[model samples]
Target: MYETIKWPDEMKPSRSPIHFTNELDVAASVETIWSLLTDPKAWPSFYPGVQHVQLLDGHARFGAGTRFETNLAGQDVHASVQEFEPMTRIAWGGYPKAAEHSRAYHAWIITPTANGCHLWTEETMRGPHWIELAKQAPDIYWLTHEKLLKDIAEVAVAREKSGA
Candidate 1:
């Protein structure tokens, strides 16, 4: 079932210091949203503060066990796919290259609905930096993710319009 994101043991609410979930019902097909989400090369085009992206597994699209490296919000992120299901669900675990002690697991789920698909994303953070940030800037991650989902929807709708 592509209903909800699967949280890893370490990222479970009981364990992780920071956890957040965001959802959006986009007016685009599942495939359109999935492609946008899984394409590492296309991230910089739509996602702000994401650049220098590379797929380490020599693949064009993300899949089970795919690895990627990218600079996010000025921090280097190196992550590997931890869970994947085509067109519906995927998740990755990553850590900042400069601060490996700060680790995170991010997951997404796309469930087909009447109009389009319901997009759901959740992220959990562990370690020192995140814990401190949670106390100081509790809504930072949630705000970022909200913007991300809005961008994804806009991109997907534009793609449908341009017939790309």
Candidate 2:
């Protein structure tokens, strides 16, 4: 069971920004998905285009108010937890460290289903150069997210087999 997260202004679909949402059903429990989602260290392992992640608070897992810095698509990103509800929803929003003048909010929702869980992630980016960035690589958004869910599902399935 789960509920949609109250998205921040930055993540709102109504806002003016390039927005995308992707989802997949996984044969893993909500707990399993949550474990992988909260662990910043696990992101680079499963998330596509993530080069590195540094948890600002020095915690292995992120909860409400946690901050982190990550390299995405070779660009530095500074972000903080925007919404965190254990086993259900998690989100963060921030800007690029460079002078791209872009900001975005990324959110994930995990809901239990008959087989396992449904994981959905959405992002909205807004800035002066947002259109140009999207134009540069239009396929990145869908392809990246599609890979992200598939990778997470594989990790979750492997974890189940390992009994970890």
Candidate 3:
């Protein structure tokens, strides 16, 4: 369990050109939320911007140093897991494979609540590519992340109802 998620020096909001954060309290078990998060295979069904996720390493679940590839932000991104604590926290740093200039770190925290769990997610991005994207839509990442949280919560509730 983590007391707090760690942010890389470069990916800190003060240093990055773009940053996004979203959170929601879900009346579902941490296991339920965590299962959805660690399963990249189920991402396309929920995460709007992600597609064709494939684990680079042989592991079936995300763990420290695990790598994965996905199509995100209109490009192919390769990501590596940096911090992972089961049922409590997970984070990754990624960059578009075709570009050498951009980088991002995404992190999630799960806090147990009286009803269930409180989920918080944040992302920090920097470099030329993100700056240009921000220019086009400064709130793009924020809006997208907001929807992602809603979607995940909805799905989690449904999954619990179905006893899946």
- Which residue runs does candidate 1 get wrong by more than 4 Å? 1-4
91: Cα error in model 1, Å: 0.6
Q: In model 3, what lDDT does residue 100 have?
A: 58
lDDT of each: 0.84, 0.83, 0.86
lDDT of 3 by residue, 1-164 (tens): 12376888888878887877799999888999999989988787678688788998898977889999988777799999999999999999999888757999989999899998999998989888878888998888888888888888888889999999
TM-scores of all candidate predictions against the true structure: 0.92, 0.92, 0.94
Which ranges in model 3 have alpha carbons more than 4 Å from their true place? 1-3
lDDT of 1 by residue, 51-159 (tens): 7678897899888998999876456889999889988898999988878999899888889999999988888899986677668777888988898899989999999
Q: Is candidate 2 or candidate 3 better by TM-score?
A: 3
* Model 1, C-alpha of 48: deviation from truth (Å): 2.6
Residue-pair clash count for candidate 3: 0
TM-score of 2: 0.92
lDDT tens string, model 2, 29-97? 999999999988788779887877888887888989999999765568899999998998999988888
Which scores greater on TM-score, model 1 or model 3?
Answer: 3
